[model samples]
Target: MLKRKISDYLESYFTPNRREALLITGARQVGKSYAIREFGKSHYSSFIEINLLEDSIARTSISKASNSKDLLLRITAIASQPLIKGKTLIFFDEVQVVPEIVTAIKFLVEEGSYQYVLSGSLLGIGLKRISSMPVGYLTVKEMYPLNLEEFYRACGISDNIFSVLEEAFKAEREIDSIIHRKLMELFRLYLIVGGMPAVVQTYLDTNDIKKVVNKQREILSMYVEDISQYDINNKLYIKDIFNLIPAELNNPNKRFILKNLNENTKFSRLENSFIWIREAGVAIGVYNIEEPKLPLELAKLRNLFKLFSNDVGLLACQYADGIQLRILNNDIDINYGSIYENAVAEELYSHGLKLYYFNSKKQGELDFVIKLDDKILPIEVKSGKNYLRHNALKNVIENKDYEIEKAYVLYNENIKRVGNIVYLPIYLMMFIKNREIENLIWKIDLSSLPQ
Candidate 1:
């Protein structure tokens, strides 16, 4: 099985002496359950699995049991499996169906019998309904769709190559053209298949883009179904917003405008719908920051924001009918800037960065703004090879008012540095993190390049 970065964290969570019950939450079919199960089977002497959504008796047992010990007894009875204190792993999948099970986690951790791992889709919605949170007891982790690095691993890329790329990235040296082209090819595939485990696996197994997009559509349908089922009061509004993302992103500014949806529609009226979609993990919001400065969240204009699908492939699938094929064949004539921008957003978000953008009325709009140490870095995404003419980025960096030291322009180009701005290929986004940005500098060895 292809390893996920979260797997290492999960392993550490189950180390020799661990206490807190684990709660894994993310969108549906992002491999939360699969990761937990894989970890359990390999790490534990015995593993007991229960699906609260499918097993009513298990749900009833969990809800009715007065205490942790009683709950264990009920589980033992249902599974007819012995619960070894330290060697057993009890996994509860789809716990959102019975959120009472989540509340019971406090007592379960207190019991200190078997190690527990709970995973559920739409967990954020369930969490709102939770009476008492397992504040001090549960260890929570949010899983996202497979990132580029993980996707590379799934494609059986070598670690040595990745290490080489990392080294080049740190030195800000352009890689060999051949290697760069190869990675770009892989990145194009990633844009189509996305980071969803199932979709990626389907692509790997069949090498069929048609099958891959079919799976993506299925997942999109599931997201719509979730909206309909979970937010019944505003299902239409939520679906409308969801369906409008592709068009919204394709706009010049890419800011989500409620007026576009409906001239009379105010952000306040559909705030819950936005909240529901975000909480469900189907979409992410990038708020507009009026000023670019440290503590980017403070200057955020909540009403002014852009909405990106959690996965780029989904966004691509929604861009137009048969658009994925057009993208793959390079046959489409329209600008695909939104798809590339969405992919960058997903990469940044998966790295634990909050999304924010800066737009100056005088300077123009920058794609994203991220905080690195005490410096505010402005990132601009360009679809084509037009890496120059970054008026917005140049303005932000040059403006003494902002005092920005460095800026980034992600595009389809080899790595290079021009003054304070760094140009990186979009695929290299997976290598960027807040801690490492300080070491990332342009140090081109011109002598090494072929003349």
Candidate 2:
């Protein structure tokens, strides 16, 4: 069985002490249900599963329940397994089909009969459509395609190796040359097979390229079907944009041009189309930042951005057949820049960073910049031998106006520190994660104010 980091996440999140409803959401085929099922079976005395998409009777019975108690009654009537109070996990899968269930979740949580969990393919869009959102009663965690670290574990790389890599990154030391070459090979394979559970499984099971490509295509088709089924009003624009992502990323600058979809169209006219694909969790949009500074959102130029397929495997599948083979052979003839950028994007996005890149006519462009530990770290993604030649990155760092102390260049190289730049292997992005949590308690000077 393929391992996932989210499995551990589910355990840590739903301890016996914390009573809360949970929602596991991501793009279709990212393995949300499988993770939930495994967690439920292992942790609970009884696991009750309700899949609305496959069970018409269950969908019909529970879709329109009048209240929390009535909903519970309807749920219990069609449950596939026993529901033991305080020891059961009632998983509502494919909940996008019956989103009103979210409206009634607050009352259900208050009732506190069984631990509740929900999952769906397009919860980002479906949850927004709910008339009443259970604001404080529910917790949400988004699942993503497996990152390099999780993929490493699945491939049987030991935990000790991970610790060594972490230590190497922290100390800015080069990995052993032999180990680095082996890892580089593995990382390229990861680009081709990707972290989608099904695709990864196909690779591990048969080690066949044709099977992996076929699986990725099936998923891409399913995404198109999801668009047609869910957003009938704007499926045309959405599909056109979705279909164009591969070609668009291959462009020189890799910034998606709205005109590419339709010569006469403007971003204002086609804004919802972009939003639909993003909300569906089928694509990642990395916005262009006007200035690299704190609060990257404020500097964000929404109209200017790069759109990437949510999974690199799907992106590769969208391309002509030989790209994967080329990637594996380490052929530098094709422009691997877009592939590298997309990999970096998926990694950064999965780790909860808002994707931003700086582009200035005077200063050139930094591939990505993110706020980490309360400061912006400029990033450059290089896939060629000329990894050290980054005029844009150099300009950004030297500009005293920005006061940016450090930056990172993710390349096919070992860890090194030269001046303010930290060069790392691209896979180390699995280690660059959430901003450090701050002390939320802000006690005021009450004595000075009142005395």
lDDT of 2 by residue, 346-421 (tens): 9889888888888899999888999987888999999988988999999989888788999999999889999999
TM-score of each: 0.94, 0.96
Error of 2 at 152 (Å): 1.2
Off by over 4 Å in 1: 436-451
Which segments of candidate 2 are over 4 A away from where they belong?
435-451
Query: What are the RMSDs of all candidates, in order?
Result: 8.3, 1.8
Q: How much lDDT does candidate 2 score?
A: 0.89
Worst 10-residue lDDT window for candidate 2 reads 442-451
lDDT of each structure? 0.87, 0.89
What does candidate 1 score in Cα RMSD to the true structure? 8.3
* Residue 89 of model 2, lDDT score: 86
